[model samples]
Target: MAGCGAGEPGDVRLADGGTFRQVLGLEIPNFHPYRDQVAAVYSTLLYDSLVNVTPENKVVSGLAGKWSATTTSAEFTLRDDVTCSDGTPLRAADVANALNHQRDPALAPAAAAALATVPSFTADADDVTRTVKIRMAAPYSFIVRLLGTRPIVCPKGIAAPADFEKVSAGTGPYVLTGYTSGGPYRLEVRKGYHWGPDGARTDEPGVPAAIVLSVVPTPATAANQLIAGDVDAFYTPDPDSVRAPGPEVTKVEVPAVTGMASFNQRPGRVTGDPLVRRALLAAVDPGQAAAVATGGKGRPARGVMAPAAFCSGDTVSANRPAHDTAEAARLLDQAGWVPGADGVRVRDGKRLRLKIVTFATSAQLRATAEFLAGEWKKLGADAVVEEVTVMAFITVTQQSGDWELALGAGVTGSLPSDAVPFFSGPIPPRGRNAGAIDNAEYLRLIGQASALPDEASCPVWQQAEAALVKRADVVAVAETTAIWFARKTRFQVAADTTIVPTSIRLIRG
Candidate 1:
């Protein structure tokens, strides 16, 4: 009764008939596939993709029964019997429409950035054999496996976006039967739901007949609910102290990059100078920052992606700048920044001030910002911390130019390629390149990696990531983790917070 094992999910499933209750912390405003800005947990549960990748990176059938992919093109042979929640056939044309619709101007900045890797999608559908051939605008090597992150929307959703807010128009195992802004959202299992990751189905004994996503705003309360068997599963922050002492509960903790800082390298900015960026990095110790952010319980950062990302490796460790305050002061001095009367670094009448933009909700991030500010003061740099609302955080990162360094928030996804646009692409209002980075070496390496197949591109991707850290475009400072507690339900989670819908099965008392 200490804690759940950290090994892979076991085959020992518990069979029960009761509906599974999944506890959530925030209120989801939208159900549209890419439009849900807050979190895509709802979208993942109600939608199915063309293919699904296991935690081990095994490509499995979801909507497409068979497929072949190359650098420039892909052909998918869809299963003949797939149907939408509305009882309409999920034809090849429908899948094609979903892929093409990502180009819609209404797509969010984050979503638009994710799909920007492939310039254009031109699909030809053959209704007779349920086949769709897609020609890419550019060479993308991860074409087949990358579909796991893309949810295919039915025709019902591609045409009318608002219609799907109440009900799901996907070929997923469950349909959204009920919804409210605050409390409970219900999901009813679709009968004969056959297309799940790795052939998981609805009629299985342990599979819950229905799933209820109930909002429990407080983490401590959700932990209590899980222990009392009132809620089947919930993600809690401080799992060790909050969770009840019991044998039935299972816990899974996943480490993700946190307390990271990115500089705005636009023209005429203080941080735009490479020497200043390097000095700023040298002044602060990332190990201490990670400790403060994680409350002394965190891991060292490994790479640009989370620990579980498909192409993750030790891309950050070998490239980080060593912590040396003397070197930091020397670099600033070499860059013509002299100590002013007030002890702030100044050059040509402009002070070396770093405005760190961080969100208000996370106490961990706040603590990290305060710690770094104190360290920067020792090097004669003025560090200012600005706290804002969640929405304002998005606005500041995407549009506002008032910030020099963004604290504790960065791009996170299941794939390494997800960081492509954020790290190197068109600047804000045009793309998600919020930092206005222009690393030609990174761009060249990423382009080469993307045009090659799966594991073959890992070396190139690592080189691209190294280029970022070497230039101090971003710092991989510390790691943070999320822990999920479960009772009377069992599932496997791929190392990040993303819930694998097919892995859930209820426990029998």
Candidate 2:
């Protein structure tokens, strides 16, 4: 297979001149649409969003041709040429079904909660006009971008919510040709996909051919496979693995979603005390955590919002709360926590000890938690690290609120609404606010921000971020560096802000 130049489409002509083959390795745990763990990689390939983001972080057309908005509602003009993998033409009814499916508690509970603010969606179609009208419940500033991130469904394939767990059907670039519950999954191009300019084919050579994604948990095994030429790519959060000495491969690090320690601000935990939470924040050394987590390849974070775009370079007071062991101890003492004989703090006969749960699959997160435990000990706090599988952590923390603190990561494209669920409280129990945070002021601000227009929403988001930072419900620790290793040396990979794999096909000689 020969590599093509940038902007030029490459085709792998077969002996029969009918089919092509493009093979790549992907790390995915499962294919459930609602779960964010492994669904991101698969969703982009097998399903279509209403709008698409370019390498430059600009919004472009995806399933919707164009969109318009009023002060109270937004409407999208659907494209008629799009079709699902099952050979059904993508229509306004399909979009309506997908939105309604997301709202269904059984099909996608998490997504539905995040989008609870949406009162309703009405789809109106006109055969002569070749367009679909999507009327929202209220004027949503990020409606276009939100729809772009939504998963387009095939109404005929999924009649019930139970079907989502077993079936994968969408009108995206790729189709699920093969899938296994705990092993590898395969996707093939949906012939005549009409979403993109040249149709929705990923830029990889023979990409329209097939995409094979295998879940390899062990870093050593994944690295060995890449070296042995068994796979074309591998997903590992560690930057060192991509930079390690190797042959027949090249490494590329794109921006990825960030990880943070979200506090469950319920009445029972240590988080119930404001001073205790402040002390924990003051105790953490983000610089050290970043160094240990990514081997000095990660960026320290100051708030929930990433610094890439919304961060203002204005000179603020440098004396704001930061790493200070003495300050942390002082705050804990002020909050009536007394040090015990074991060197851990205790208050009201109960030790000021808490269990910090994090996903074991991510090497960076696990290491960061260990480092945090040691740092908290210096402040007379006993911090226990509990490493659990991604599913277990989600089930216990997000679903049951059984954990005190958990390590998590999320990627928000250039939209504020994308980050809403993380801070919004009224969103169902299992919503993104797994922290159990319920702040009336914060909720009001989020609602206000969502209703504002794009130009006016920026300041609203800035104010909301400031409120989150002041409350200390969740603290952003580091910005992840996505390292990608490629075997083809002749092509240059395009770098972008999106954590999702895009512009992979734009690799050129």
Candidate 3:
């Protein structure tokens, strides 16, 4: 047995004399399952969604062996042989308990809001059926995809819903062995785990043996760790970091989750002024911003829908807004904004100065904010970038709704349906619609799109997106780039459409 010292370079022998070691650089803001704003690195490793989007962006079966859905109801049949990390049988009751607990308003408000449409969930254990039934309020077509993509079932033995928050108890291949609520989180392979896709696991090989996640908030540190052979892989938003010279590393780029600056449309600050919002959009150079923010790794976004899918060819890239100081000045001038003695625009005795807040954790975002501030200044608008912690940033954006503008990212697994919450009215408190935009026409179109289940829905979504663009509630800056840098040449890693890493397998020589 050999012990490896901290910050040591090169290969070190393990206790069992295995020469292989894979280190992963994980940049995480927070890891709490419920309260934390960002998804925990451990969550992905410890919980298996009922369904998952494959490397090709197609939905595939996960924990639920098979499932069927009607217009208003859905059902899932559990695998008979699956067991939790503790060797507890994963019965239908366990799945039901997880859903029921999530549905409880007191226990989990976020999950409750997501599942509010579900009328009921019934589990049947008789005759070894292992069936879980769900009744929805309406024909929620996206429910199947949502359920398949992110349902983390809990065992029935957990006495309280709060127990789930502290315990990583699921029937996945990996189990939580250690966790720190807001920082580092770690997981280890669950021995004797029996539930994965057929051929996914072999009886002789057993589980992964160990899985660890180190939450390094700095991208530089993450990259350094990967290069030093401290981590097997890491996620980076800046393309430059991934492109930086490194040894035994590979980079894989996928469609990025969209990033934008949202304005709260409610009546209050300059954000409530349509002219100010439009001016802000016109003043931004999305192309240059993308180049700087993502190291030219991102594509300038034209509309709400990702350009890669469902985008109409007629939608011209030139029509995609960019930095035009002259146009921004004209718009501001038309809105009765006059340049004051300080070279800042003013309307009705109010300075055009605005506070632009973003997360301090993301270096790219901070740099983008500075770039935007300069661009906004050229248009006679005073802008300041306020860097805050992830939790505080989310709170201010959601609770006070006082932010003039926010630079952030939107994560979606599908089209149309995923875009619904961003524009729909009666917006979920603290939901993605930080803009608080209330357009009756846009809301109506969103409703119409949700009811539609085929290609026809594309136009409806496009129309709604165009309306949002016209309103300038939020400016779509860039399509996210999900790049995975791996050091191991023997392993194959594929990037999924959801920007998640998948199809990982060891290529034996």
On lDDT, the candidate that comes out on top is 1
RMSD of each: 3.2, 4.6, 5.9
Clashing residue pairs, candidate 2? 50-148, 51-148, 72-139, 203-505, 204-505, 252-484, 491-508
lDDT of 3 by residue, 283-375 (tens): 777678777676566767755554434322222244444567788888889888899999998888988877888877676778888888888
Candidates 1 and 2 compared: the better one by lDDT is: 1
Worst 10 residues of 2 by lDDT: 12-21
Model 3: CA > 4 A from native: 1-42, 113-128, 156-158, 180-183, 197-199, 202-207, 241-243, 257-259, 303-327, 361-363, 410-416, 422-432, 454-459, 489-509
Report the poorest 10 consecutive residues by lDDT, candidate 3. Answer: 1-10
Give the distance in Å from residue 69's predicted Cα in candidate 3 to where it truly belongs. Answer: 2.4
Compared with the true structure, the alpha-carbon lDDT of candidate 1 equals 0.76
- Which candidate should be chosen as best, given TM-score against the real structure? 1
At residue 228, candidate 1 shows an lDDT of: 79
- Per-residue lDDT for 1-509 in model 1, tens only? 11233233364556756698998767677777666645354566888888887766778888888888887888888888899888998888888878777666574333565676555767778888898888878877677876534788788777777877677788888888888887688898888988888678888777777899998766667878777778888874434336464787777776677766889988778989889899988887777777887788886677877777777788877787788889999999999999999999899999989888886656677777888888888899888999875567768878877889887544566666778778877877667778899898998888898788878888888889889999999977766676778776667775446568777777666
Each prediction's TM-score versus the true structure = 0.90, 0.83, 0.81
